[model samples]
Target: MEEKKFDINTLIGFVLMGAIMFWWIYSTQPTPEEIEAEKNKTEQVKEDTTVTNPTTSEIILQAGDSVTLAKAQTELGSFAYSTTLPSAKDSETILENDLLKLVISNKGGQIKEALIKKYVTYDSLPLYMIKDNNASFNINFGTTDNRTLNTKDLFFEPSLTKKGETQILSMKLKVSNNQFLEYQYEIKPNEYMVDFNIRSQGLSNVFNSSQQINLDWNLEGFRHEKSIRYENQQTELYYEKDDENIDYLSIGGEDDAEENDVNWIAYKQHFFSSILISEQAFDNIKLKSKTLVEDEEVDTTFTKAFYLKAPLALQGGELNYNMNWYIGPNDYQILKKYDRNIKEITNLGWGIFGFINRAVFIPVFNFLKGFIGNYGIIIILLTIVVRIIMSPLVYKSYLSSAKMKVLKPEMDEIAKKYPKKEDAMKRQQETMALQSKAGVSPLSGCIPALIQAPVFFALFRFFPSNIDLRQKGFLWADDLSAYDSVFKLPFKIPFYGDHISLFPILASIAIFFYMKMTQSQQMNMQQPTQEGMPDMQKMMKMMMYLSPIMMLVFFNMYASGLSLYYFVSNLLTITIMLVIKNFILDEDKIHAKIQENKKKPKKESKFRQRLNDAMKQAQEQQAQQQKRKK
Candidate 1:
């Protein structure tokens, strides 16, 4: 048996990984006091919302007091007359078309439930954009009678009407029929967008001259995907600045930003979203996204909690604002149709990589999707197309590697001639001279590989963000957008997760062999590097194993579609490598060509002359230092 090599870097890596695992496990476990607090935690979502409202304890106390009209009037002030409205006893009115179902609540004149009729959750339950009665959209302002009020605390009368193919619902918090605050909603057939308008009808005197009217919208995004951690990483708060670029909150932790000239705010989920758009620009916006989980299984009900405090751009003394609400999937095709830059919210990538995905990958993928029923087959075909396009680059990189391999014997001879550490600079100078004479640039191999990186990254962004892959089945994977667990472990394996996914395992295996083949090409030259440099061979060997292990652990809970792409990509790479090595490359011919080129008159460029001069100066300095020490 071969003795294992002792590597300090590998040892340190293991120690750090062990420390991280212990820290993660320790940090995620709830304390005894936290368990009790979670038991008593209010279902009303008071903890996440920053809006000034009666707490759960305060509400309970009021309910226990047997409050009367006098007590209500004192608390509600001029808006107290709304308690006796026509729809005071009514709970909800439905405004829906074929694509969407929205329930407008009589209590707050806000959307109580919004469900997408075409889709369902991972477990085949009705897909709700807003449910559990936990979402709140309240307008906060002061009344003329020196009383502050919130729309959620008042009841509104609801009226549902239909015009042509459009359904409309108007909820009015009537001081009377002549003076009221109205929330009008219009839903058109076969549309996911809802036209919403909040305008007070004739309330100039009943309202005070308050410039501090604020709109507080809070939502706890429901978990629809199977992997909470995977889904939460995708879920975040995104906003577009008016006449500016799109920006988003950090996904890994709590994020807060004060934005100006806001065009819209999207409480984006993994696949679904609830976006609020202002027809006019909004100024002075306070947006926040609080990550609801430190561990995947700890908080599974929701992905992230969102809070927004935006001052309404009031026209007159009353609220008069036109807006549209988008409560649907984060589909690229659908979102791109909107004039606003809502398409950016779907994470394709950024800069040139994003351009590559949109300009090249999306069109090709969608074209393949047009006739192909099997997504797995489509992915395989896509990989083949990508490999064919990148074949020239592959050939060039392989040719460069072969040239270096041909030069290995000479490199080993040079290493033997200068065996002492003191001759390191001379060895490097000779190596450069030899490479220059043979016309083999060291950077030739690196440039092609670097150019190919964007395509891989573009596809990495393409897979998970591709909504077409959701719930699509292939082989053992029932949902291509989620993990394909082949076997379930009895207990968690720290960083490796609780289940074994076959696609990622296959992908990791392919990566290991692919790296091994590449490393074999590089391991030919037994040459020592500069005196103070790190051991490149040991580092490369360490990476050859570490990379696959990392891939296995990371993609364990990631989207199966991404894993499938990587698996097919690596398999194609291995096949291409084999074809190039066995049939195309002629080692004997390459060696002959190198010898002929080296025999031809060598031209030393300015860069080479400067480098040789610098090395000679360094050698002289080293000699002087050695003599002084002696």
Candidate 2:
């Protein structure tokens, strides 16, 4: 019935359908000239977009079927000639010298691996300073088509040549037969240094001449030591800039920026280093380092990763730079010969302590090493020489201790006269006067002890960084540079470690006896029981026990050479103290000297007068308070 009525809504719908059909037919039909014009316009649009916003691998995949390599190349213009797409197969070129073997890959034209021929890892495996695709050297620039290009991703053609005792590897990425970017590496026999030179010709047509190029270098340092944690703690990135003092990143991990011109950058491991030295310093460098996770599977294989980005200014439509890569042991002599302050990579303490190590300990150690074949014997000789040099200070400290012991009876009488806590100030005043009369300065003992502190710390730094100590065998120790494990436990301990190191145990025992003897000597001295003073006797007792335990725990995972040094040094100290007590000094004679000195009239020094005045002021204040109370 509705169809028969021919409703107004049905009439409007019929009219709309007919109009759409007419429009579709009109839009579909075109003349030959129109079709050709449309095709050219589409191609032009594509070229414009590709040139302005060049697609990377990620962008190309996102474009799906809408983009093709053929279409992309057509839009590349002059850049298409220089572009070298990476292939699935990568080939390696080997450059070997007497001391080093370097593997360069065609994929990146950079060092893929570096092997130190004379050394091996702590586990006796071939030593690899750089390997496992862990190192990358890249040059990044913008192509003429606005494509972001990295030399690391492009394939290169490699050629080898020999000149006398030198081997040269040339890796070239060709734009044309006459135009290319080349990386030339030269290695000489019996040398750890490799000369690296980069040169480019006619690349100004492919790359923007106005823009600067960025060089990015990354290295993942593998662990060559027995202890991964120790190696990580010792590994650091060192760089020299502007001929100023050498600077370094924190050993574990850190990020830093260098605003000045940098001469060299070194990735220093525990026993070795990979250094890059540039003839022309690099400006505006950003460096970062990250410690590797301690995985049971890979802990012995790697220590940390480092990244450095530097900028280079291109000149006259060409890029030319020369650098040297020093891949070798962290030997002081070898690195010092570079004259680049590269030797500072060794952790030889800081300030005066470092000075002592460099000036005294290193020289002495080397001298001893020349004469002695056994490292253990050398350490003993070193301890003896150090103690002999410090004997005068040791004697002064002993004399001061003896004088204090002799004054114990006189000090006790003062304590008895001022029995109450309120009389502490008076007792201290009388004790000072008694000491002044006896000509015994209370600081004399501590001053000599403090003077020996730098030497102790100097030796602390020397042992671990000594490459000669690495893999050296001592009694019950396989590697003097690493912890000597007497027994390995199945389970790990928290503060103590998973193994018992014999050297640390022996060192702790020696330290305990040395402390006990020193504490016994200190106990003979009368300590004033002032109201606010810490109990010196109690503190001494605690230190006597606590220090040995700390040494045992802390030195367990330290270098065996260090533990051996401490053990020998402490034993020598105990022997020296015993000899001093038994033969060198007589207590009866010290007492006689104290009595003789007390009988003589003593003039008060300015410091003593000021101390007395201060004491009197305090007493006057106390008297005022008492009067007020009355």
Candidate 3:
């Protein structure tokens, strides 16, 4: 209360904040109307896709056998499987195609390579490679280079099945050191999951007969490169004991870092992999090892068992392996059911926060998603709920502010009484007394806001991984899935660069309005300390303007969704504050309460007494030092 200092530095900081906000608003003007139009366009895109049959392919599948192929590029690395089933009315060929880079099919059924293709987007680029445009998968059945290898006979041999009863389709491969190998496959119709069995008969015999039998199986024309990742997590290379062993793992090329990459597992790049589980333990499984053949004409055999393929050779002892192959998307609900830890593939938040994400945030978000199909709407609803939950604490903060306002007049009087004192102890004591009488703490408002910082940070982390919000439209934003820009600049600016986004502008405006409202309240009630001292009210007014400006400048490049939430929250807070200030808090009641407290002669706490004593001792010490110098 010794003359409240009006610091020039505070005013300068505020001006800078305002400048920043103005720059941002000028750059990113709002396109609220455009966002609505984009929403309409998104619906039309879905409708157009349904009407167009652009993916209609003419490949046919017979009743007893099945075939799978990829229709993208020369390499059919993706998968397209077809099987005909006899329904009561008619025969239908069930074809399931879905592509996800890193996932196990156990949760959402068998993952075919075809379904994992994801599209990339950029600010100014045309989408090339539309889905299902590969013309190369059309196979001439009897031709060797037909590319689309038929697994029908091997999996669904008509002679082995009954005429009337439905046969569950399957395929198995047995390789021996014998000159010729007989292969068979069974076919099942209208089924999503498939199991595999592969045996390398007489493996020890083949090992003894030949120097070494190199088993190299390639899922050619399956149109997909494998991705290594845990369930419901970011895609990263699988870690192994030896880092150098990465050379053996031939997934996709490093040059194509934008998409598929070399996973950590030694041999998991080419679809799913499993070694022939013989009673004998094998030493190692290598990837992309070059086996230079002196004679190029040697026959290479291909065997199919469900969605898997393996090369067979002769051996001394039979080496057999069994495995359930899962090739599917990283759908959390679907994968959690398999108990294979398959849900770890989604890019949910990581670390202790990740634990919170999985345990608390994800469940809450999923629940919200169930009710609101539109992700943008869901985020808005979620924000409202969180705000409501925190309302009580927020109200307390307002109460603290109101009480401080009531004590300002008395605080000013005490400051005037201590006009000539270099001893700050008396001034501090008077200020504390005023605060105690008013039942207000200086830090109460700041503490509540600080407590909510973690919640804000957690929400920031949660939104990006929320794929459900991708391509969703909110007010002035085109794709809540990506950045929403109203205009792109012809030239780049120094700190701000170019590219204007409307959401940030709207957010800045809202922030400014809210700050102005709050600042007005704080300023109008502010009282000056000494006669010559500058009013603290004016300095606070400058600060109120500055902070919102800083926010506007900084948040322009941030996600529209984040800015939207903040803008809405601030607006609501301002509304609530206004209501409380006008209808609930009255000056007469506050003054009466203060007078009542003063008449009662409230007892000081030990901490307050200690602080007052310390200040008094410091003031006396300084006075003694001054007297000695005189």
Q: Pick the candidate with the highest lDDT.
A: 1
Instruction: Give the number of the best model, judged by TM-score.
Output: 1
Candidate 1: clashing pairs of residues: none
TM-score per prediction, in order, is: 0.85, 0.84, 0.51
Expressed as tens digits, the lDDT of each residue in 1-630 for candidate 1 is 999899999989999999999999999999999888886776446653654465322332343244534455667766656654446543788888888999888778888899999888899999998888658999988778887778887778888888998988888888877889999999999889889989997777777776478899999988898888889999999999987689999998899999899999999998899999888878989999998877895547778899999987556677899999999989998998888788888999998889999999899999999999999889889999999999888888888888888998888788899889888878888988899899887677778889999998898889899989999999999999999999999888887788999999999999999889878766643346667888878887898999899989999998998899899899999999899999999989988999999999998899889989999999899889989999
- Model 3 segments beyond 4 Å from truth? 1-114, 117-364, 419-421, 494-497, 520-554, 620-630
Global lDDT of model 3: 0.45
For candidate 2, give the lDDT of residue 315. 71
Better of 2 and 3 by TM-score: 2
Candidate 3 lDDT, tens digit per residue, 116-196?
A: 234322232221111222111111111122333332211111113433423322222112123111222222232222333
Clash number for model 1?
0
- Pitting candidate 1 against candidate 3, the one with the higher lDDT is 1
Of candidate 1, the 10-residue stretch with the lowest lDDT total is: 55-64
Q: Is candidate 1 or candidate 2 better by lDDT?
A: 1
